[model samples]
Target: MREAQFYNKIEDLIFCNLCPHGCKLSEGQNGTCRVRKVIDGKLYSLNYGKISAINLDPIEKKPLYHYKPGSLILSVGSVGCNFSCGFCQNFTISQTGETFFTTFISPEELISIALKYKEKGNIGIAFTYNEPSIFYEYIYDTITLLKDELDIILVSNGYVNQSPLKDIIKHVKAINFDLKAYNEDFYEKICHGSLEPVLKSIEIAYNYTHVEITTLIIPGLNDSEEEIDKLSLWISKLSPNIPLHLTRYFPNYKFQIEATPIETLVKLQRIAKKHLNFVYLGNVLLPSNTVCPNCNKTLIKRNGFEVQSFMTSNQCPFCSFEIEYIKI
Candidate 1:
């Protein structure tokens, strides 16, 4: 295990300041993440260099509609997470302390793999599948080495502390923050984390890198119209151009409920669209192409991961309005 970063020691107790949990450990105790453990009087990362999942996936799968639509990216993930969301989609990796399924890969080796995929329209690497922040050392090392050569993206729970987030977001090209809910009660009860830290993290990332948000609309949990209105309005305060994905959540992991109704998703989408210029639905068959906010013209078309860009340049083809993103 590699020595972890962003930690403090107080009277022989190791304090993990990686996230908001601030888990103070004593003699072989693990942090809330379960990946960082106190061993031999120091904090060490158990998930460091242990990659549980890796794949060359489409950028759209990251649900990043505005960034680079059709391009592919090399996505990798490690086990362990700070949050304990009951409806975690990738619970097999995210909620586990087990590294039995993980393959050890060095930072240099990951860079090599990303470079090999460049010719096949691969943009860069995405630290995804599981919570990437728990293994802070590995991500920092890899992104530091793989700078500028390829775009770095993260699909995160947004529970990370600001200092470490700022350290990494400056190097990151894009990120999809999972804003699970707008209520504090939901976060504390269902996710085992706080909402304020995630909000702060999102605010920080917005200034440093391209930011997008994904909210898995769980039935009767976070799908309320009032909450979505507040959520979208909050995002609009940041920037209306920031794409917000309202994903349809099905029962998974500990939350065994029915799938989200299509009608419910549509209603919330309408509510969110009032505050945000770009709001799209996911996890169901829906028309989610990017349209010009000014002219209402379809700029990018997507059918299940197959994307075709109609925008020849950065501006809209029909309206010539300046777009914040590049042609995909």
Candidate 2:
């Protein structure tokens, strides 16, 4: 177990500042995330180096279309999450505690495993599947050990506090940030979190690395046209080049609402495209091809996770438009 970063001890209790929860815990008490705990008056990350899931997945599976298209990444994930979203897809692991089964893989061991897959086009490690920020110490240590030898990708909810967020952004090359909604009411009632910090995270992350935003379009929750408009506009204001993914949500975990309509995703895609240069529809058997924003020329054609065709490099051949993608 690693002593966690971004925490302080007050008397006999420890306050975790890793995320917005700011959970204060006495000895043997776990935080809202169910991973960090106060053990003997010190905060410890219970999930540190304890990997619950590991796989070599297509970069697109991270739903990251813009960064490193047509490449495979070594994806890794632990348990526990800061936010308690009602419709969590990975709830089985995210909501669980240290009792959940996990394999212990040190940072050096993980890097060695990644090196074995170099011929298979493994770019680097992706800290995903659960709220990675909760395992801040492990990730920070792993990235420090890597020293940019491999790419570091983060798929996160973006609910972390700025101080910790700023430190992690320096090591990551790209991120797929989940912007659940456009307003605070949806965040507080449905996600058990706030929206302002997420927006702040996106704004801060894009300045340091390539950032993409994903919003799971839940039915009757955050799928309204007005909400989509506000979200797209806010992202565009940051930079129209920021890729926005409008994913269809299925009933899962506590929220058993009906699956989001394909029509809703289609409509939201159009709404997002009006303001954003790169808008893609996910979780449906639809075209998620990336096109040149200027000339409408196809840059990358994807069929599910398979890349059927794509530009040889980051530049569009038809119009020579410089696409904002990591070409390796």
Candidate 3:
């Protein structure tokens, strides 16, 4: 196990400042993440370099449409998540630790695995599947070692604290932040987290890396039109060009509410598109390809991960309007 960072010890207690939880633990206690444990009065990351899942997936699967369009990325995740969201899609891996099987791979070995996929269009490695921040020491070392050779991206819940997040964004190329809701009540009740820090995290991430937002629309939880309006408007203040994905939520983990109706997704997409230049639907069958914000031309077409890029450059082919996207 690796000794974690962004922490402090005071009067026999270890304070974990990695995320908003700010968990203070004694010997043998674990933080809210269940992966960071207080071993002999020192906080240690138990998930460091212990990979639970790995796959070569399309960049769009990270839901990152703007960065390296049509390219592939090596995605990996460790066990443990900071939040206890009832509707967590990857709860099995995200919610557990030692109970599940994991393979221990060194940083150099992991990089070797990533390079093997480069011939098949793998762009870079993504810290995903579970909360990447939970295995803070591992990802920090891996990304630091694998710097600049490939694009480093993160698919996160935006629940992390400022200091560590700033450090991570320095090397990260792009990130898809999962914004659960707009109101504090929903955050507290549904995600066991607060809204302010997530908003702050997004603002911080924007200054560094390419940012995109995703909100899983649960039936009665966070699907309100007022909330969507406020959410989209808040994102627009950062930049309307930032893509917003409205994903359809189904029964998962603990929440057994009926699946999100397609009609609701369509309606909310209209509301969000009003304040945002790019809006797309996820988890259901529909075209979520990149379209020109100025001329309404399809700049990138995606059919279940097989992407066809139409824009040779960052400018729209039809209107010649400047757009923001990274290509290889």
Best by TM-score: 1
- For model 3 the local lDDT of residue 43 reads 92
Q: Is candidate 1 or candidate 2 better by lDDT?
A: 1
* Consecutive 10-residue window with the lowest summed lDDT within model 3: 319-328
Question: Scored by CA lDDT, what does every candidate get?
Answer: 0.91, 0.89, 0.89
lDDT of 2 by residue, 195-313 (tens): 99999999999889999889999988899999999999999998988989999899899988999999989988989889998899889999989888879988788988888555777
Candidate 2 off by > 4 Å: 325-328
Query: lDDT at 124 for candidate 3?
Result: 84
Number of residue pairs clashing in candidate 3, backbone atoms closer than 3 angstroms, sequence gap of 3 or more or interchain: 0
RMSD per candidate (Å) reads 1.0, 1.2, 1.2
Write one digit per residue (lDDT tens) for candidate 1, span 69-144.
8889999999989998888889998888889888999999999999999999899999999898987899899888
- lDDT tens digits by residue: candidate 3, 265-308: 99999999999888999998998888888888888888988889
Best by lDDT: 1
Off by over 4 Å in 3: 325-328
Model 1: how far residue 29 lies from native, Å = 0.5
